[model samples]
Target chain A: MYVNATLVAQLVVFFILAWFTMKFVWPPIVKALDERATKIAEGLAAAERGKQSLELASKRSAETVREGKEKVVELLVQAEKQSQQIIEEAKAQARIEADKVIAGAKAEIEQEAARAREALRERVADLAIAGAEKILRREVDAKAHADLLAQIKQDL
Target chain B: MATTGHEAAAHVPSAGDYIVHHLGHLNTTGHPQASVVDFSVINLDTLFFSVAMGVIGLLLMWVVARRVTSGVPGRAQAAVEILLEMVAGQARSIIHSEESRKFVAPLALTVFVWVFLMNSMDFLPVDLLPMLWQGATGNEHAYLRVVPTADLNGTLGMSIGVLLLCFWYNIKIKGMGGWVHELFTAPFGNHPALYLPNFLMQMIEFLAKTVSHGMRLFGNMYAGELLFMLIALMGMGFSSMSGVGGSLMWAGHVVAGTFWALFHILIVVLQAFIFMMLTLVYIGQAHEGH
Candidate 1:
């Protein structure tokens, strides 16, 4: 029925519920939304940080590859130079060894030729003295005189 | 009225009589026992309270707008501004239409204030003004219900107003024929066989919404008013009891009442705001045809 009591009672209950909703229910819902927003923000920030680190890592990797290439090039150059020097040293040593062997062989052949010439000279002198003595001693003998005269003429 | 000095006197009206009397409205016939809105006579209290509160709300908003400043505001101005901002924000989120919100937002805010004022009427001592009016008029029968929301007629009237707005927006947003066609063809294909099911579903939804909206407010306020009456009765024992018990009753009455009244203030404002927000949400939904 329509009465003042009913009006008053309804008002009381209505207000109580209104208060409960405003004070209790509304806040948590609002807070839940705010929390979600905050979480999204944090996630975006973390992703940005990860992106930055990735870029830095890529940059370092590129630099390392460049440095390695330079080192490889330098090692190649050094190896080539070392190999050229070894070749030159081996060729020079081989040429000097050939000259020494040729000089020793020529000296040995010249010494043998000198000895042969000296022996031949001594033998020729000794034979010439022996014919002259025989001719002086045997001049008186008949047939030996005639042969010694001929050998002396030929020697003169 | 029991909290007031005169009602503080121990006079315990019987529960049935108390409830009936409290339930009675201030009708033009000036009879406490007369049934207003009955098949016989009409109660003017519901109509009066609704119109009066509605006017008060409009006047308040108008006054606030008239005195609004671009600079720093006084406490009154600031409070009104905050209230306006809150109402507008809520309306914006719920309604999502600048055009409809032009009326709906302010209407929602008005509902909150008006309903809040209606609910706050319960704070008046139950018998204070009614008994005073009776005494002054020399009439043995004078029933007055100050709180408008306590009356089902008043609440139903408000809900009906909301329903009308819903229908209006539905027409404005989705044209008259479009809304009607959608009503028939919706939630199913445009087949003749499914029309009945769709129509029934639509009708049930609308009916359910209107009834529940009205009853939810009615039930809550009605229960609260009954509690005040019960508490009023407890204090009535202060006069009828003996020395020690009477004193104790009086003390308990004071303690319980002060506590309840204080708590009730918060309750009153909250219920109003909820009703207002719901109004906005419902009106917002109406913007979509389906």
Candidate 2:
């Protein structure tokens, strides 16, 4: 078998390159890739966390809006109830004052009516006395005339 | 230019002479290999050129490495770094064991660089060195083929080395008894009746793997060498021609040579990368007992 020098030389050179490059170049390269992969994983985790938080925030914001709306509605209902109560109170106060005024007017009217009735009775008695004197002759029994006046007054 | 060379090589020397001379290395002291493998008969030409190119590639990597920064890198570092990253990544994927990968990863890188440096030899002017040597030595018998990848012997030798590694790993990772037992009982039961068939199948598998692994490298190198020869023949034809055909020959040599060289760049890198990946894969397979 013919020996080949070229073949052996090539083998030597190849082994040398393999040794040198593997020692210096390949390790760092492999480490670089590992680093890049780790970074990507971390970035993905962060992004996932960010998305989760964003979702939670959005949900909370929606809940807050709903709560705010509910609060507003409750306040409006309370305002409406308060206004209704105030109106009812105003109406009750007006009714009480009106009842007091009507009672005072009725009492005053009754007292005035009693006084006018007394004055009208007195005038009627005077007219009856005058008419009796005119109808009778000059000297008649005063006691008998008084008795007739009383009867007339009683009959009127 | 190539056409001129084509006519010359087209003469088609007798097959015996052709094979012998083409296979012969232009040695330093008339002996190419050592006594067992002629050390003195060293193909100094190939060694000089191969080492020089290997250094250039290493220097290139080193320069790029020196330039590397944590910030946005330059194109050179980026490209080299990308290649380094790709090779390491592939090595990790193929050879899972960290201890094994320590060696295997470097093995793959060296495979790529050495093979690539060897492959780049095809780009040198085919006659430039040989003609120069003939002029300097006054002897035309100093025929040289520069590219190591173009040498089938070199490729086969490499494959053989890988085969040896595989074998060593297999035996080491799996004890001899385990290996033998697997040979006799695997894919078939441990039953006495199936032993023969199992052993035969197992033997065939080992033989097939070893043979194919070597042959694959041999075949690719052989084809690349043949193509270079053909291209060289074209250049010879152009030189011979003086008139129209001769001029067209020069033009044909140039155009075909340029296109082939450009396209060959892809083949060279691809072939190296493929061989490296396969080496990793085979080594990984060896790590497994079955």
Candidate 3:
């Protein structure tokens, strides 16, 4: 209850304590708080950047996939056209080979018919000469009938 | 003073004498101070407890400061940060100058923690420390008042320290000439006849702020301490009473003691806050014009 020299002593102690706190306690804690706030802000910004990059990558992949699908469709169409052209060329080549074979067969048939007719005419002429020799007496007119036999052969 | 049971009962101090004895402080003179105001005597108990509380409180803060992290804070670190934020917030709102806040904020924090610790001393059982002191010193009539804030000198000592800071800030912010001029011209006018009245009013304002600042904390803590003493006196009455009344006195003692102690918890923290706020306000006023 009394005010004595203790008041003065306490006043001195008070200043000392306040000074000690100012020197040792206050700054570090406040600095930590500020630093923590900065760190949280930076972390949030980084997270946002990561999210944006992820979105961009997804979009790019989707575009590439679409491009790949179109390329596949184009290749399929080109292959189908090439296959149709190859089938048409093969049909034309087959038709030409068939016509050549038919013409060669017709030529062979004509040659064979001519050879057979010649053999028949020669045989007929020989038979007529034998008959004439039997009908007339032996050696008469052989030279005179030569021209007629030749003409008959030519006609056949 | 060592005596058998019968002699001990006879030697026991009366209720009034017991309270008066507890009120006595351990001072330089080795006796209760007789004078109402004496500059020569020092209350060693008040100084010792106040310094002890100050040292302990600051050491805790220092330890937390040493290990503080910008990352997730430990519980102790978080608690200290909360207290610092509250003090710093008040300081920021009241004191406009960033440069001045460097010192003033810490000063407010120191005042809050130190006063709160000193006020918490009231929670100790009234006779606990004194009895221990008597046992250690082997003095049957040893004096020890634990709550430093209960002593007018201790509270006034701190309030006066705040006053000195106010003076420093006034001079620092408003230069010596400007402060002196304001001291005379403020809350009145620039007129020459108003100077004397303005000066008088300024002095009274200073005096009133300082006294009320110190007296508020002192009065609350002192009254709380006295009420504890009175509650303890009821226990003495219980011992001296017979069957029914004795039991009733005992119940009253326990009930009153518990209720008062619980209520005093609020007062203890509130008084600390008021002291800190007033400190910021007064220093802030010093930064402003009249």
Candidate 4:
């Protein structure tokens, strides 16, 4: 129990242990702790960045969908207008074709009527000449009948 | 008192003999003589056990440090990490200077663990190691004290180390001249009239702190060792008795031993922590200007 050589030996051991611990043990453990802290901070920052980008991407995708719907609606309206224009153009074309066909038929009928009348007038003039020959015999009235024939043709 | 082997055991010792036997140290010069001041004598048991415990503490720390991982920690790793954090936290609060803490924190940790290991040696049945020593060397009266902290020399040795650190920091933080000046001048008054009184008070304070610091641990642990010896004697007393009284005394011995051992767990750990904290606080105080 007295103050002796053991006390001095112990003090030396204490100093050596303290020095060894400070030199070797402490720095690495503290370094590990600090590294873990920095790693956790960086991980949290990365997670925050990912969350923000996810929100941005979701918003962008939503806007893209809305724009696509608007374009589809505009395309549908344009298609409807084009179909209406095509229907009106088809109706006008049919009316023009009908008018042309009716005009062609009227011209053909007028030509046919004129031919029939000329034939009938020629036959009537022949019959009149035969009756006059019976009434006034032979050559005396031939020269006067020429003017009557011409006047009869005009009346027909 | 120096007798060994079967001859020493042939005579049943008185209470004084038993206590004296337990108190004696295994010295470099074979048997330690009873002396109030024996500067040349080295207590071999104190040196052996202290170094052994110190090595064990260092090995435990080294293993934990080597296996430390950033990944999920195993139980051992986790336990060590918690201990490290606790020491770091105490050092951080007490010692503000980061540079000082690099040495002081680990020093505090070593002190705690080494003292704790030494205190825990009391948990071993008081007679176990000495009996083993007796059997091994065939010295029936072999003297060995396992609990290093129970030795006044050992505790005071550690406290002296702390005193040295305090002195170092005092000199480092305040220049040597400044520390000397403050030691004489600041605590009472700057006047020359108060210098002697202040210096005397300062010396007394240092002496008191160091003495109490070492004595407190030595007193507690020494008392515990004594209690264990007394309790063991109670069992020995009953072994000579017969019948129910003998059985009862045997049972009491076991019960009392178990109870004290359980309770001493708290004392051992608490004493170690208190010693470590006081060391840090003293050193921290040294770093501050008066």
Candidate 5:
């Protein structure tokens, strides 16, 4: 088994096979591997992004709930303050109405008292004139007692 | 003993004749009596079997290529992918040039598959192919060797191809001048007097590497082939006696042949891998500066 033309033939076949493999076979297989790697990496990245977004959304929802609770607390306090102010206004109004009614009743009583006193004073003047006429016997000089009557009236 | 067609018609051959007959090749030139190192004689059997194995290797790669997918792979696809990854790993570690690997990696892959196929032919019964060849040609002396790697010419041919690749890369990577200068000054001082010695040493190293690379594979496979023949001869010896002893010999042949074949599977794959690795190493070294 010595070397001869077969070696040349083998060399030719080796080169052909090597060249064919390099040109046709290797590229596609390597490309498939690389593509699969990139796809897996991209999937992982997307999953990471989705997880982050979910966390953010949960945090945002929690903040909204807290803000809603705070707003409800503030509204309840404001409503309570408004109700107190209304109660205070109603109490002050009732007090002022009572005071006005009392003042009207006092003015009416004073007018009525003044009227009664004037009537009593007229009646006393009349009765005193009649008694003086009776005591003086006759109508003697009733016209002449005008100045006395006036003074009596003044005294009454 | 397992005899060729003509010997089968005649009396049994001596052990030497049997071994010599098994070692003969179907040559394209030169007589069977010619010297072992006859350059004009081409071993037709080695050429035929190697080329056939090479085609089979190419077909296997081609089928995998055509059917390969990016998704989850089937068993065949997975097997090919694993093989490819293994070759790529070796090439990456040895050959530093990413560009050269485009060629070198596939070259190594082809070499491994082809040599492994050739080496695997040793598993077949040693007389099977030759007997068939003798029968087909109607000639008792038809010389047919089944395992191509068992032949020195086949292994040396491949190693010489690797050597040429090494030389090509040497020139391509380090210019011709750089390679020549390195040959004269490598692994020693750069004195004018040492140039001849350095160059001679470098040549010897190349020669030694190529020769050993080829001889290692040839020796292993040749020994294996011879062992199979001897085992077959033992079975033949027992069969000629025609008794319980003959039956025992048949059993022994089967047992021994099976054990050896089982062990040889490792050699088949290992030799292929070693040859591929050396190819990568030599080619890689060519790309490196002294």
Candidate 6:
């Protein structure tokens, strides 16, 4: 219960402990805490930047897909138009070839018909001459008949 | 109490004597103190226990401080960091100057940990250390008090340290002339007629703060230590028992001691916190004008 010199000794000890703590203990711990705070902030900022770039890349990829789809559709339309033109040109060429073959066949048929009519006329003249010889076999004067025959033939 | 060993034929101490002996300090004089306010004597028990506790507490903090990291912390590092941040936050709120807090915050942390460790000595069996001391010294009546904060001298010693810091900060923040002027003139008025009253009030305020700060911790610890002794005496009642009353006394002692020790955990932490807060508050006031 007494106030004694121990108070003074304790006071000196107290100051020594406090001075030691102030010099050694407090600074490094506080520095670590502040540094951790800064690191977390920087990490968060980097994540935000990464997220934005990812969004931009996705948008660019989607735009490329849309362009590719449009080009495919345009190419298909052009191919379809060229195929239709080729089919039309082939049909016109076939029609011209058929008309030329028909004209050549018609000319050959007319020449064959004229030759057949001439052979028929020669055959009629030979038959008529033979019938006249049979009839003149019973006649009296041969020299006189010769002149008549020649004149008849001319008239025929 | 049952007296065993060589003291069986000797006279036994009364309950009052038992408590008085437990309260005695193993000082340089090697005897009980004669006066209530003697500055000439020093208490060796209080000095040894306080410095030892201070050293142990600081050593723990220093180990953690050496390996402290900005990345993920281990259990020991996290525990120390939590304590450090709590003290730093409190100092930040009370003391506005960052430069002052560099010293003041760590000081508060040291006070808190040191005082808490000292107060925790009450949890040991009241006679364990004293009995051990007696055995080792071959003096059956050796005196030893383990808890330093229970002694008024130790508490006042630390409170006076805080007071000195207050005075130093008062002069540093407000120059010597300004602080002296404020002490004599500001509380009432600047007039010469009010000077004496203002100065006296300022002195009284400083004295009151220091005494209460020290007394608060000392009184609580002393009362707790005494209660533990009383409980121990109750347990001792059964050692010499012959009837049912002795059995009841032993049972009561167990229940009361257990309950008190459990509740004392809260008191121990709260008293340390109050002392630290008051120390910071007083020192912070020194940095202000009024």
Best by lDDT: 3
Best-to-worst DockQ order: 3, 4, 6, 5, 2, 1
> Which candidate should be chosen as best, given TM-score against the real structure?
4
Q: Candidate 2, residues A1-156: lDDT per residue as tens digits?
A: 334556666666667766777677666555655666787789899999999999999999999999999999999999999999999999999999999999999999998997787667656876767666678645445586778766666665
The true-versus-predicted C-alpha distance at residue B242 of model 2, in Å, is 2.9
Name the docking class for model 1: incorrect
DockQ of each: 0.03, 0.20, 0.75, 0.63, 0.39, 0.62
Find the candidate with the highest DockQ and give its number.
3
> Which segments of model 6 are wrong by more than 4 Å?
A85-156, B1-9
> Candidate 6 residues B20-133, lDDT tens each?
999999887889889887778889989999999999999998998899889988899889899989999999999999989989999999999999999999888888888888
| lDDT by residue for model 5 (B1-290), tens | 37544544567776677888888888885246365455666778888899899888778777878877787777876787788889999999999999889899989888888889999999888888888998899987788888989988788888888899999999999999989999999869698999999999999999999999899999999999999988887777664656888888888888998899999999999999999999999999999998
Write candidate 2's Cα lDDT for B69-180 as tens digits.
6555678877877777687789878777888878887787767777777777767765566667766888755666566655544665577677777877778778888777
Which DockQ value does candidate 6 get? 0.62
Name the regions of candidate 5 deviating beyond 4 angstroms: A86-156, B1-17, B29-33, B132-141
* CAPRI-style class, candidate 2: incorrect
Q: Which TM-score value belongs to model 2?
A: 0.68
lDDT of 1 by residue, A12-112 (tens): 43333334434433333334435656877898999999999999999999999999999999999999999998898888888888888888878877887
lDDT of each: 0.69, 0.70, 0.91, 0.85, 0.84, 0.88
Estimate, for each residue in B91-183, the C-alpha lDDT of model 4 and write its tens digit: 999999998998999999888888999999999888888878878999877888898899888999989999999999999999999999999
Decoy 5 TM-score against native: 0.82
* Model 2 regions more than 4 Å off: A1-9, A110-156, B1-37, B56-98, B128-145, B151-157, B175-230, B255-267, B288-290
Candidate 6 chain B weakest lDDT stretch, 10 residues: B1-10
Candidate 5 structure quality by residue, lDDT tens digits, A55-131: 99999999999999999999999999999999999999999999999999999999999889878887898898888
The residue ranges of model 3 lying beyond 4 angstroms of the native Cα positions read A96-156, B1-8
